[model samples]
Target chain A: MSAKEYRFRLFVAGNEPNSRLAEQNLRALCQEYLPDRYDIEVVDVLTDFEAALDSNVMIAPTVVMEAPRSVTLFGTLANKAAVISALAL
Target chain B: MVENQLPNIRKCHTRIEGLDQILQGGLPTGRTTLMIGGPGSGKSLFGLEFLYRSALAGEPGIFISFEERADSLKNNAATLGWQLAPMEQAGKLFLLEGRIDPRAVITGDFGIQSFFAILDHKLKAMGAKRVVIDALDVLMRLINDSRREQDELVALHQWLAERDVTALLTVKAPREGQLERNYDFLDYLADCVIQLDNRMLGQLSTRRLRVVKYRGSGFGSNEYPFVIGSPGITLLPISEVGLSHQALGDRVSTGLTALDDLIGGGFRRASSVLITGGTGTGKTTLCSVMAQMACARNEKVLYISFEESEAALVSAMRSSGTDLSSTLALGQLRLLSAMPEAMGAEQHLVRTLVLIKQMQPSFVIIESASACKRMGTEQAAFEYLMRLINTCKEMGITVVTTNQTAGLHNLDEISGIGISSLIDTVIQLRLLEENAFLRRKLLVMKSRGSSHSHSVHDFAITDQGVVILQKAD
Candidate 1:
């Protein structure tokens, strides 16, 4: 809404199938929707366990839309319609 | 029952000093203990302390919280002087935050298998011997259905038992008779059940803990008062045990020579002496005289004054030609001045015990008993006084107290809860009407283990503090 770049953070547990799938799905969704207007950051909870607490992520493979309004999606983020509608992408 | 011949049962020391004593050494090991209490009743504090202390004792622990986040849990523990973050990093303790919002929980035929698996992983990863599940009610509510709740609870208890880890689960209790459905189920599932209560009588609040059930073990089945204070929770099991103090034979002086002669010599060492009198009858003066004599013998005397300040008492004694300041300066006398309305009866008892243990005084004088009457109800004041006397007698400390009667006419009145029998010696002071003038007289009412003169002598307050005009005839 403010013409600022969109920021996304994906929390994963180090190379698990669901973690990799969530990362891949979020990147594809971001590329198709925002293209060059969004930035994606991947955090491995297995290395920085305290980061999970900082981000308020209870489940692994969680996608957080940190910009305008802040939304959380749990699971593999493969449902593009649900993710887009929930995040207002 | 004989103490030496008791059966041997394995127990994991709770690491809480007084609580372990109340539990008869410790809680039964490898069993689930359900701690139920209302809000602010210290359930979380107790559970956290158990895990923290066990971890400090060389046993790893896991704290699985379903109510608070790991960061908030760390902050709360920090307030109690427990450095939980370092322990978490050192692998000695593991904190798992598994809190789920109630509205977001979809309860369609779901169970707690996944949650149990998570706990299992964490426990196995750390090799923790102690585990705490704080606020199990949150997870219980997530189960929604009753059958799943029961199955999950039973399985969780069994899982902890199988791994031989002592688990503590905290649950919130409902108001008086409105027991929750899950609470009833968990009560039966846990091997031991402890109930913590915070009760408000009028304006003061008291925390108490009771063990409702302890399987295959013997414990003090009485409600013990606990305070969540500086270090952690401390339980005061006052009346759980019987009295076992040894009596002494040596006698100590009462300071006044004529009064001593009337009481057959002096007071028995380690005996509780009570002085009861009406206003203006010089009861406190007599106690001051006895305290002076004890200090003169180069013995430490602890004088607890509720009605007067130390400076006022010292000035008054100085005016009576008694040099109390010298004894105070020589470290033979310590004066503690406190108002009865300032603290509750339990606080007074704990403070008195702490001072007695630290000072090791030979004589303890509570200046006026009427002030203690204002602390609480008559029963509370009586119990506190009894415990004080019992503790002092156990350590061979001479106890003396002064009480106020109703009037000058009723010389036989034993005021302030009527604890005449609890005392070893009772002296009654009264103002007798004589020739349009009032004269103070002292009478020996009861003296245990010794015969005393029954005659009354004129008691007077002069420059020498307390002076007996006539000898016992």
Candidate 2:
């Protein structure tokens, strides 16, 4: 079987400090865990506000892991170990 | 032009009629107003009403409910005849779901930045000025620490002011014995703080809202009785009625000749008359005689009976030889009957006030004002009667209220009666316990302006109406 693909959606306010940090942290965590086998979609709520709202993302630095089981994480994901534990990677 | 005006705390109108009067213009503009109350105290309703009204008044509003769903808020608003969905669809109002799934474990540290981020975007896009956050404590749950909760409220207050948004936050007051969880910090954080109470008066609940604190504005400090009725939440600002409402009324008869002689040659028109007595003291009969006499003079009379039905009142008065059928038929007398327990004190007052406005009666007879205690509490009844009397005097309508004193209480006590100052003339009726024979006596306890007899006289309710017997003769 092909390696299980990891899909994730990150909602953020446009170019906010925490939003930028959350994006970098999430990408770093995913690259180290499931390198070349994960998908990350960054949605800037300022431009496409409804997309974040549609996913029920009320916080800026929120990550929704859709593949290998769905999980939601809040904040900038500064604690990469916690994010890794949350994604079960 | 608006900016050219001197900067001050601009009042945002709640759109509630009397609420604005007591609020001295409405809530302090663009400042967080903290509404704290126990459950069912009408806190959420008040917040929702403020937004609904501002939206309809051409200013947009956004309602962020953290605990209740937007659909549920819409359904509740519909009961108030507020078409919230249409307003929402028109972009005049918006209901944002502020709830987060409780089961979702927060594995990392988080802040409420995204909520504000979304709100900041929506506020400008909708051009909304009013923002109501219902169940603010639920949102505060995000800040697990009490100190952090306080900090968040401070941040929220500053943010709202910077955006010039009038924010109303409804927080569930700590329940009894949970004083440690009090939101005293909210009082200091917000520019205004209001407390709502749904007090249990006997078996019924009567709601009262008080402005606990207003930073740079004057508000009615006394608790204002409010009702969640049609249209929306309406507060009875009885304190707003100044003493200047005193009417320069003329003299009017009290139906009985000798009784009028005792009460300073009759009661003053547009003045309030209070009758205090125990059961079977001929108070209702005396009121009937006055009602009949008013109708005899071609003046309209509105007789509000709390205990007796309209037909019962008519028949009872007929037995006392005061036939109200002709006057009632002629529209000179309108008889309204309702049990005080049927509604809250606010409703009883509001319904009667509406009738008084529609009828424009010269005399309003509210039988057994003490019965109003059944509507709520002693304080509620006192406020109700005070507001009614003030309204009557303001409209030049004479008012007669009866207080049914219990047999155990002394006549001087005037059971459940506290509005003695508002009363122009106070008549006391008592049953003289003489040799097992109950003899009724009428005494004019107080007459504001007129001077007359100070002696008590025996009275009888005979077939020819109430007769003040000449005990001296």
Candidate 3:
């Protein structure tokens, strides 16, 4: 039997207000809504700025939900309900 | 002793009190400064104030705005209280607004050479010493190639520098990057860089200006908070000093003795008094009474009615028994009626300043400042109003502005846009329904530099105008 699991990675630039808020929001959603079903990776672009640039991340606090290919979303993570729904978790 | 050497080189004076100190002697003369900021940071206003002050110094200036139409710019400037139309007519100030297509430039249909030629001709024709290019970002967007954009900017800067013209270029900071990253190119090219920032402090949004770089001159590097007030923008560099009280001893009677008594004699000259009330609270009637009082003293008065026409204002004042017809006939009272949407906020400001200059009035009244919000941009409208108020104060004119508060019971709604902070004297009028009858009450919230009676006076608008009733002790 095979289970369909989802994987997500949030690329953030340093610990800016927008970036920190996005990471906190995404982790909270994974714990409460998608517990035991998804793997979450939080990447700080400040430490790995080159990787963020190579991934074509023009803006910070970007959430990339990877099922097969990466579906990237940019903007502040202030909208928790919308982000959770958008990632289909 | 023979003094051959000149005293210290003096910085160009803006002529507006308190602003020169913040600029550390008024925007580096004969150099281009880029003012970059987000919306509501007062970039356009900074440019307008620079030109207005230069014009007052007998230095002809030109304002080239791409974001706003010509008439709109005029209106907004008028609202800020800088009269630019007359200056334009007298060849002291010039305004140029036109459309440029980026695609056409990319296709080689539009040449940058022609643009410079046109600008040079206008500058020479007007003999303009100062030039303001509002929103350089808009112009950059019209050029498809990055190299061409950079070349055009550099060329323009060099051309202005060669002509010995001090120019002001305004740009919008990118929404998502640090200040250094957002305006890297502009910061590199400009001789001076001024950044206007609006930040939310608790519940209030404060506007602060910082001089990031000034090539060869000493300037104030600390953030200076500024308030857009009557007469124009005044930077508060020294907050410990209170000067709003330093004004000529003059007063205008408030028609109603009871209300006048509450104000301690009457409204002080050069003071900004705000009359806020709910609907049908006689705010307009009270303003008319003050206008009539000013005109009765043989002093010239300028009345800006935003919600009513000249004919309607005259009729309303006439019905209230304040004979404004004779004042109009004698050229003592000039009524300028404007529909908020008739022109942009900047244009409105320019017109108001023009009227003030033309009439040389000692008193000015803006009936219903709330209507100004209905114009193109609310931030522009507020900025213009503040500037206009500041200008009036500088001219030693008593300014009585009326604002209609939203929500019948919410004082918070009245405080929206931070208008209360700009006012020197606040007269709040509330409407109460008692036994199915509406009663209007006026309360003096605070008056600077004067001991005002803290009493809520009952007032009524009849054919004889506004009558203040004795409050029950």
Best by TM-score: 1
- Candidates in order have lDDT scores of 0.77, 0.80, 0.71
- Number of the top candidate by lDDT? 2
lDDT of 3 by residue, B158-219 (tens): 88888987888998877864433325777888878888888754234567788898776666
What tens-digit string does per-residue lDDT give for candidate 1 at B207-232? 78999987767778898877665567
lDDT of 3 at B366: 88
Worst 10 residues of 2 chain B by lDDT: B1-10
Predicted candidate 2 versus true structure: per-residue lDDT over A49-85, tens digit per residue: 7776566567667788888888888778877777777
TM-score: model 2 vs. ground truth: 0.81
Model 1 misplacement above 4 A: A1-67, A72-89, B1-8, B64-127, B329-331, B408-415, B471-473
Ranking by TM-score: 1, 2, 3
Q: B400, model 3: CA deviation in Å?
A: 1.4
Model 1, B410: alpha-carbon shift in Å?
7.5
Which prediction has more favorable TM-score, 1 or 3?
1
Clashing pairs in model 1, backbone N/Cα/C closer than 3 A: none
